[model samples]
Target: MHPFALIVSEPIKIDIWSDIACPWCYIGKRNLEGGISSLGDDAPEVEITYHSFELAPDTPVDFEGSEVDFLAKHKGLPAERVHEMLDHVTGVAANAGLDYHFDTLQHTKTLKAHELLHFAKEQGRQLELAERLFRAYFTEGRHVGRIDELVELASEIGLDTGAAREALESGRFAPAVQADIAQAQAYGINGVPFFVIDGKYGVSGAQPREVFARALTQVADEKAA
Candidate 1:
């Protein structure tokens, strides 16, 4: 009789720190998903954890006009040049299966959004709401910084609106937001789309699928040992 083949199974966890306002972060997320799915059913059961990292932490609650205007004003670029950049990003986003509506995007700080995401974590819908928030800002052109908009988005994703609003209004999740930022700083992570595989391997930027695939396999091997 042939000897039975041995297969080692293990568990893995991925912690991701990103912000909704970040475009590359969403692209990186899609790449990571591709790598994970390639591992198949026999692969380790992975737990995904989302962390809050606001990209535009200093943005104001309201801006004078469009995203283009805001970018031009903040970066000192010509309005035409900023629009051109927005066009380029919009094209890239579409190719990545995302609909980017920068024209309607209102300039606002993300502190409240981060706090709301922390609130979503308590209900186990942190990942979903995070994705939704990204979509709303980068695609739907919704003002993500406002409490009412966040409450509406939360409710749309099956969370309790009242609870989310309360959390935002009362600043309940402020500590969680600060903690994530502090941890990122502690880890020397000053950017989005940072991936920590099995809590051991860290990858930054919008890495390619193959890179993530290799990291996934490496982490799996380390765990099976």
Candidate 2:
């Protein structure tokens, strides 16, 4: 091999459409990370970008119900059925190393939270903010819809809280959020935790870690070819 011969591998770009309020999205995130880790030294360089997708756009900023109540009404399912579903998802989340607290979860609009994600993206802290928001809402039962609460989360992640507050309050990233939604619609996506790998493959739902690993490996192989 010539010493001047170099191997250049381009990173796979993954566009993820998820809502902060979606339990499956959080679980899927963990599974995706797990998949990447499973590859160990063989893991390909990858860039992930989270896009906005509102699961409940009409939910009030200060929704007056528990997660179960909200789901029951939103899906028009019986209260008992919602409880069963939450229980099942809670177990699934636990398997993904997540502690979902549906009882204490405050179901509210996630538009402001999505806006904050865009602000974080501008600061190159989008991934950090996304993880923080997921844990805050799912495990900590923190209110993610309020500007003040979001600003606090931003501060926790070493962001400029003042700027975060101003951007969120002024709706600076609303259009970006809307654009993401429009793109999702164009892709015929109607679910959360949807993964688009290298603009070629579409992997939907909170799939097992092995599934994600296969997708990543396939894309890497194509790039190599």
Highest TM-score among the candidates is held by which one? Answer: 2
* Model 2, runs deviating above 4 Å: 1-7
TM-score of 1: 0.88
Tens-place lDDT per residue, model 2, 1-225, is 889999877799999999999999999999999999999999999999999999889999999878878998999999999999999999999999999999889999999999999999999999999999999999999999999999999999999999999999899899999999999999999998999999989999999999999999999999999
Candidate 1 residue 158 Cα shift, in angstroms, is 1.1
- Residue pairs with colliding backbones in model 1 are none
Best by lDDT: 2
Residue 63 CA displacement from its true place in model 1, Å: 1.9
TM-score of each: 0.88, 0.97
Error of 1 at 105 (Å): 1.8
Q: What RMSD does each model have against the real structure?
A: 3.7, 1.6
